[model samples]
Target: MRTTTAPGDALGVLETAALLRELTAGLISAADFDEALAQLVRTCRAAVPGVTWCSVTILQAGEPASVAASDEPIRALDDVQYGDDGPAITAIRERDPVFVPDLAGSGRWPRWTARALALGVHGVVSAPVDIDDQVIGSINLYARRPGAFRDRQQLTAMLLAEHAGLLLAAVRGRVRADRAQPQPVAPGDEEVVGHALGVIMTQRGCPAPEAREVLRGASRALSIPLAELARRLVDSVARHHPG
Candidate 1:
């Protein structure tokens, strides 16, 4: 997104630039991800009259997920949006700001549309939030009146999304160490396995399969090679560990 530039409002530009600098510096120092995300939506809604409410859904590990929201009717959309597991997922794949002028008539994400319709919000503008080319999350703006967001409002939403990404990445980087689910280690470590195999090629003087097994055994025992033991094993002159 193009940053706010080409200004007649010198003070506004300075203030905006200052704020951007401050935000960039603190992007990774947010207090809490959930609170920060909710605040982003709140800030968006307050800044734009048409947007009375907002919500944030994130892609966690290639799957759609909702982090936080205002907890109104739109709150229900999370269970499905969590993994792009539902229709609302369309908003995620859509790069341009989506202005749902009328949720009831909007056929996109049928289930999501139905839920939002129940909330009494006539429209919403959702935009993808990106940081350093990575799409971190999306911001959804809700309007009490039908067809509230104009082209200008949509543009503002995109601008809001940029800052949102900075804040979230910062907040999430910290919170993730605590809240993220555990990841498993692959059964066989690639580097050690390959290194062991290479070691066997020189010491075993055998075919690939035999070398692989020899390396496997040595690795499992975590054996340290001794001179005598190393000599006992056959050696291919070309194979050498450069000191």
Candidate 2:
């Protein structure tokens, strides 16, 4: 099926860039890269309007693995795709976005389509996430309604996948470096970021991703690393509202 082009306003370039920047900073601030990746898929599920489930695939131990998923049960959907010609696999193979606007209308990947439809998934979009020039994976989004991912939605998913590729590269580099020289990590660092996110969300009445963007924006303006900024924020909040 042909992919539709998104209009200028469907998702402005500036907005897309901002999202990528925030996501990059948030990933860098994370204490555990794997858990951060899991959080990323969750954030994507929340950020994208029509996405019913989201998953990220990457090579682990020389084999494809679902590194992160929005919901644990949704991993079943990804499992069906791993050994089949599913959209996610095709997207990685072709290094392009694969769009299945309506699973009922398409005969491709019979196994995946049937499994998806049985689970109330009617639309799927898979975009390739390049780990490097040669290695690639995919970020897959599933929707419950047909035609859920139109021009704008598809573009959003693609942009997210593009940024996810960059983040994965960072993760891979970190893993290699850790294997060479182990680093000590602080306890409760993850909770610091989570607490800061909660504070931001409560203050702005926004979602976790939006709060993350706000935190990133603040970190940028203050010239502080995201993790440090989050720690400071949590400390300040505790000081003022001491229990």
Instruction: Give TM-scores for every candidate, taking all chains together and pairing residue i with residue i.
Output: 0.56, 0.68
Clashes per candidate, residues 3 or more apart or on different chains: 5, 0
lDDT of 1 by residue, 1-243 (tens): 333433432234555565455545444445676567666655565556567777777766555545566766666655556533332355567565676767777767675666666777778877877643443567777777886766656666676677867677766666645433222224454454445456677566777788755544443344333232233332432355333
Instruction: Quote the lDDT for 206 in model 1.
Output: 74
User: Which consecutive 10 residues in model 2 have the weakest lDDT in total?
Assistant: 176-185
Write down the TM-score for model 1: 0.56
Which portions of model 2 show Cα errors greater than 4 Å?
Answer: 1-3, 6-9, 60-62, 133-135, 182-243
CA lDDT of each prediction against the hidden true structure: 0.59, 0.77
Misplaced by over 4 Å in model 1 are 1-29, 82-88, 131-135, 174-243
